[model samples]
Target: AQSVAQPEDQVNVAEGNPLTVKCTYSVSGNPYLFWYVQYPNRGLQFLLKYITGDNLVKGSYGFEAEFNKSQTSFHLKKPSALVSDSALYFCAVRDFWSGGYNKLIFGAGTRLAVHP
Candidate 1:
């Protein structure tokens, strides 16, 4: 079964500093991983993805991730951290089931707290 893991339950960073939300995945065949951010009482917002093409994939809000096949890791990174960036982060992998039904297998969720 395909699965994702967020090693850290929470990450604390100071505002204006770089932040990283780590994610790792285990899957059969090709790997499709994604990063999303959720604010309080808000839906998950798409951040970046590593479907193919490049090892380093860029996405919204100055965020990016590097796909490392050797390590089986896809860690979300931002050069700078902001108070507004404090939220719940999730890493998901696409899962394919019988009958062509596909779904997302998400991690437990990592809470990012940026302090001023």
Candidate 2:
């Protein structure tokens, strides 16, 4: 089964500092990986995705992620953090056999606390 795990329940970072929210996954064959952010009571905002190609992929709000095939991990990263960036993050994965619905299997979610 394809699955994702976010080891951290929360990450604390001061505004303007680099930040990272770790994520790892398990899947058979190739998997489609994604990162999403959500503010309280709001739907998830797409951050980035790793289909194939470059190991490092950049996305909205200056966010980026590196896909490590060897480790089966896709960790979100940013050069600098913002207080407004504080929110809930989730890592997701979907396998080809799961159909083309983009029906993702997500992690428990990580809270990013960015202090100004």
- Best by the lDDT measure: 2
Give all candidate RMSDs, comma-separated: 1.3, 0.9
Q: How accurate is candidate 1 locally (lDDT)?
A: 0.91
The sequence of per-residue lDDT tens digits that candidate 1 reaches over residues 13-115 is 9999999899999998888789989999999999988888989999998999999999999999999999999999999988855234447899999999999
Q: After superposition, how far is residue 116 of candidate 1 from its true place, in Å?
A: 0.8
Candidate-wise lDDT, in order: 0.91, 0.94
lDDT of 2 by residue, 40-112 (tens): 9999999999999999999999999999999999999999999999999999998657777887889999999
Question: Least accurate stretch of 10 residues (summed lDDT) in model 2?
Answer: 94-103
TM-score of each: 0.94, 0.96
Local lDDT at 114 for model 2: 97
The residue pairs in collision within model 2 are none
